[model samples]
Target: MNKWLYRLKHAWAVILGKAKISYVKKGGFSFRDFTYSENEIQFLNSLKIEFLFSEFGEQRVNGGGADFQDKRTRLDPSLTSLRKYFPNAKYTVYSDFDLKIDGVNLIKVNSPVAHPEHPRYGYRTADYFKFLSLTESDADFKCVLDSDMAIVSSDVIALIHLTRKFGFCVPYNDRQLLRQDMIWSQDTQPIEDESLGLGHSYNQSPMTLWKDDERGNVFYKKCAEIMKKDPSRSSLVMWKTAWETGIYPYILPKQWCLCDGNEGLGEEVILHVGHEKIKEYYDQ
Candidate 1:
């Protein structure tokens, strides 16, 4: 399986680089299909920080979907709200509608490639890479957060401070039951990319910080090779590689980074509310 996936990753990367493949949506999360509760939108408005809302997919005029069809409809409320927060912060969104979002600049591409690393079919490191490209002129540092997040006043500053002080920031979460063993051997559970060399921060969503010193283009290209080999093990492989390569300096005991999985600390600013855990948090 790893070998097959590796071959696929290699093929995906090559095809992506050369502009060879077409990005077609199979079933997955689409932001346009999601509705932002007023509370979530209001919370985002309260943050009072300049941020961009990244949206992918066609704009849905009125929400409707075909039954038994994978076709997704558009919802622009998030983008609508994002405009409120970062009005002058280069407001725009991208879609394989025929271009790639590389940070602030949108580049037209012939082929719409899938970034297997991200859960979203169209979202890629390239988009954030594009965001980082704008760092020189405006922001001292940029923090990437997911649209689903409900950003409050504290998060805007806390995330900024974390990245500024630590040189890195991860979601405020903790370790979960590793559904498999941390150390991988074929006899043990299948080992993945973490062994190949990558960062353990893959699980951190909505807020990944890449400094000017770290070139996301180079890092993601190298990491994609490992992800192709084993999609499931990609996170571990990326972490293992990052540690071995020393791409980013470490700050740990793992506690200071705010592991939000098992424990919730009072001071933790951002609330993740991932797709799986959204119901749990929403119900509460």
Candidate 2:
């Protein structure tokens, strides 16, 4: 869909008090369908932080059907809420298309690998761009956020402080299970086993922070190596490497970044609404 027409429809939906917008595949809707308020833009410009998000046009199921018709719609509210919460921060959207949001900057980036298919996770090539951005971004402190979540609190500023002090942070989570033999294979799991001791579990990547210093640069280099080995399994590889390298992520408190309907929605910093079906639970 042409970006302007989608924005028009989105505006109409808001004027009608409808939070959910019906999206049909190829309906000319993009992630920017939910626009930001002028005040929101002003607020974002005031913050000195930078945020990164990535999106692909439309993903198809294994059989080539529209897997989730409302996936983008489900993401709209979260993105809208993030804009409201972090008005002063710089939000950069990385995608193949040039996206425009009132308070967001869109950067056109190419996939690092051909077909960038995750062998095990089935994620699209676009999903791996965050790693590239982490390495190349000039921001002193950069945050990569999933489109499926919203920041419900200003504690993110505190989180940034913590990341700056620790060198890196990800939503505290468990170590990913990997095959024993695959542990040493870059094509399977890229990080050296020694690095896994930093943390035994994979910090969920739904929300993560990276600093632009020595530690942060090392993390980015590791991520790049892992992605080159297996673009499709980059997330898993990252978790594995972080654990093996003893570069475990500083886990964010649950109250700060809850996922899958953990609770305390009113006080949490972020709510990661997993998928369309799960999002309905929160929508209610």
Candidate 3:
């Protein structure tokens, strides 16, 4: 069976702002503060399901002073809150140390790439590839999420059913180009493809549903291999190849994910909290 899972890139503040996406702002984060409000608590209690959260770790915030371990700890509330709804649900927090939430295991990716290198290190896609490696052996259906994401109770069931129907589900909207000042290139081919339904758009937020099967592992390995070959150019090559070839058919778009960006303030449907802005969203 095909897996249905959502994925997102945890970008930095500068990157997030430049991408024209909005995010939550609060104090810096600590594991103790991730507590959900009573309303938030009640909402999570309503769902009775299990899901995996593949949160990208602190590497995304290179320049920030926020503590990585604290951010990781802060996620416990969301994990605990999720357990309230998904009793059988387990969480696998990917990091250097193995931790557990409820009965869920926290998988660790001690790969060399996880270490600090240069200013331009740990590309968001690279972290995703590493996280995927950790899940390659699991047997349950997998649902990957960016750490900054919060889902509505209604979307829970719809996502499950939708994934079952379509081999994959992605939230797509008109892909708007970054401002002229932020434009990385004058590439119009992709712009046209986005218009023609031959292109896809997303930060891969709570990109959901992955079957605990070989196909999932195979797909993960394929991505890993591509990055291992040339980590720097893999993203560009992937985009280039996809554009040159008709690859959008492989990705489904029946229920395009919604981004706040569509609403004027540019809410990133998946709220990509940048490193600099971590303090803005969570109490420091």
Candidate 4:
């Protein structure tokens, strides 16, 4: 199909409040069938879901005059809220230091790149570790949740179901540059200009989901290549590569993972509190 026609069909589906699933043949492989309704929840209860969180035990302090504690201040409460919403779901924490959460598994792993000499050293190391955890974890399906985020809705099962169908999902953030020019169409291709660095648009990775299947394996391998090219900017590279390669299909509905940007948390399931504006909103 022509790219414009594909966009038009998707526009029609959106106008009718219906979901559109498109299959494109590339490298002799075609995407399988998957469907999603606006508010429909399905196939969540039977999935073996696990949540992964990465914290580097840094001493970054917030405006509250206290150390930005990952365990005592952030992860503890975040885990409590997550368990309350998802009682049967398993939890794992990836960190350089040892941690103890009652029912959560702790895995200590070191960063692949020594960041002392990099330009943006110490920036997004935890983000890189989050990607590493995907390869380290044994779960069939994995959802990476930042330590600062809190689960606010019991309907998170809906997100799990969406991930199972879509293969991967990321929350929509208010960053205009990240969202613009990111639509996946037949003609969409990855940017090869190294000078572009992070490229024009990408997913907000504060909270994301991944499956352990073939698609997930390919996605992670690409991410690893990006990290090898530039360790300090792995997060940006992952999104850029995904968009350019058209490997990851779609972004989850905004209601699934809400960020602390311009968008209000009107029916959002997960509340991401990593931004300064959100911290101010919660008076933290």
Candidate 5:
């Protein structure tokens, strides 16, 4: 809360106000993602935006395991789309071993948590890098994007707008009903605060938009504490922590930021390549 920092935030607030960004909400629904003025892109590009991605198991490529067999194939296209939105933005990849992707900065860190015995990919333990990068990032706006996805026009700007609007942005969970409190609690809900809200989103996709500010730091610090004890067994941690911290995210509608579990992927969406099952969804 330094005076200069506070003033700087205030100054940005005023500049944003002057930017005259208009939100053209799809279907006129308040909760849905909106299309912004094209002029806003320049201003958005001027900000310090960074895209975070992780490839924990390079060996997954050679394996027959479906969990991440084709994940590496998705990285390049995703990067190309990300670069389109934020032409001068930073791209960071958190990996377990040495990796070189053109125009990407790498942080070779091993998985901090071991996967619990699960027949499935044990995704909870595998996504620790998603938490690690977002928590440690110093960008003005940080986006946690799955390597399998591509960014369409204005999607990046929309995410940043939501983070600034509601303190954070996460895609709406289509299967939110499956997120029983007992189910999540049995899995060891990280920051236990009974007074806070629960199940605002249960998508468990690592995709997110975070602004580097006071509330953002609190959210990251809470995740850091969870990492020490829990260490990203699932994206449920991100969804739950956002609510518990009172930084209830703006739900980027089902059509935009589309993923697996979100069915009926017609030709009316913004982002479609998110889950390992995305290929099947595309085939259908």
Candidate 6:
């Protein structure tokens, strides 16, 4: 994408300002909107589902702050919400410190994947551990969301159905245009034969969903195999894998990745709090 064209697209987006998911910003996240049949819920529950979350206790927020590792708390509430909604789903946690949450699979990584000394901040700031679910597990379905996510009130059952129907289910970059470089670098892309670039789904990998079968993980295993070329390009690995598998991504409603930057547009099912902006919960 040319720099000028990208800017023009962004300018048009701001001018149009249309987002699909709307946050019920007055009182609370009304679960009333979730109206599914028992059979539908049962069918969803029957499938093996896994949610991946990571919080490095020792990992500092790139720059200095009063509460550097404050995002650790982000997992508890988000996990609670997920459990309340999707009780049959399995949860996985990857952290450097000891976390004693019941029914949640845990992995101990010796260190955060962040490399602050490196020139590229993507390696330092990217949620690299989240990709572990893709590499380490073989559940029927897998999910990994961003740390900034304050609330996930989306229709989980429907999204699961969509994942089964489609290949990768994820949200769009509604607030801003994510650069192409973040998805794939020209020099370090791992796929030998194909380019790892996506046109329809922007910032889709951060809040993504996919599935595997008895055969094994189709997308992630490929990424793990080629990650050695440059592990820093996590999203690049995913894009490459998706491209090769022909399992293109399904772009969810833009509001799933909504933030303060795009409030008042409509109701939001998934809200990502910057922690730097509101420094609090989704108190609506």
Ranking by lDDT: 4, 5, 2, 6, 3, 1
- What would the per-residue lDDT of candidate 6 be over residues 45-73, giving only the tens digit for each residue? 77788888766654434221123244435
**lDDT of the structure predicted as candidate 6:** 0.53
Please report, as a residue range, the 10-residue window in candidate 1 with the lowest summed lDDT: 61-70
TM-score of candidate 3 versus the correct structure, residues matched by position:
0.52
What's the lDDT of the predicted structure labeled candidate 2?
0.54
Q: What's the C-alpha lDDT at position 145 in model 1?
A: 42
Give the count of colliding residue pairs in each prediction.
Answer: 29, 21, 32, 1, 1, 6
Q: If both were scored by lDDT, which would come out higher, candidate 1 or candidate 3?
A: 3
Q: Is candidate 4 or candidate 5 better by TM-score?
A: 4
- In model 3, the Cα lDDT at residue 179 comes to 24
Model 2 has a clash total of: 21
Q: Put down candidate 1 lDDT per residue, 67-153, tens digits, no spaces.
A: 212222121222333343344344333333543333344433322333454553344333332233234224444444444433322
lDDT of 3 by residue, 141-195 (tens): 4555444433322224445555545433334433432222123422112333343
* Candidate 4 lDDT by residue in tens digits, 2-78: 75884576566667868655543333433222233443323445556688887775454332132345446447546
**TM per prediction:** 0.46, 0.63, 0.52, 0.67, 0.66, 0.65
Off by over 4 Å in 3: 1-50, 54-72, 76-81, 98-102, 112-116, 124-126, 130-137, 170-198, 212-218, 232-260, 263-284
TM-score, ranked from best to worst: 4, 5, 6, 2, 3, 1
lDDT of 4 at 141: 74
What lDDT is reached at residue 145 by model 5?
61
Error of 4 at 55 (Å): 1.0
lDDT of each: 0.36, 0.54, 0.39, 0.57, 0.56, 0.53
Regarding lDDT, does 2 or 5 come out ahead?
5
lDDT of 5 by residue, 242-262 (tens): 656766555667765676565
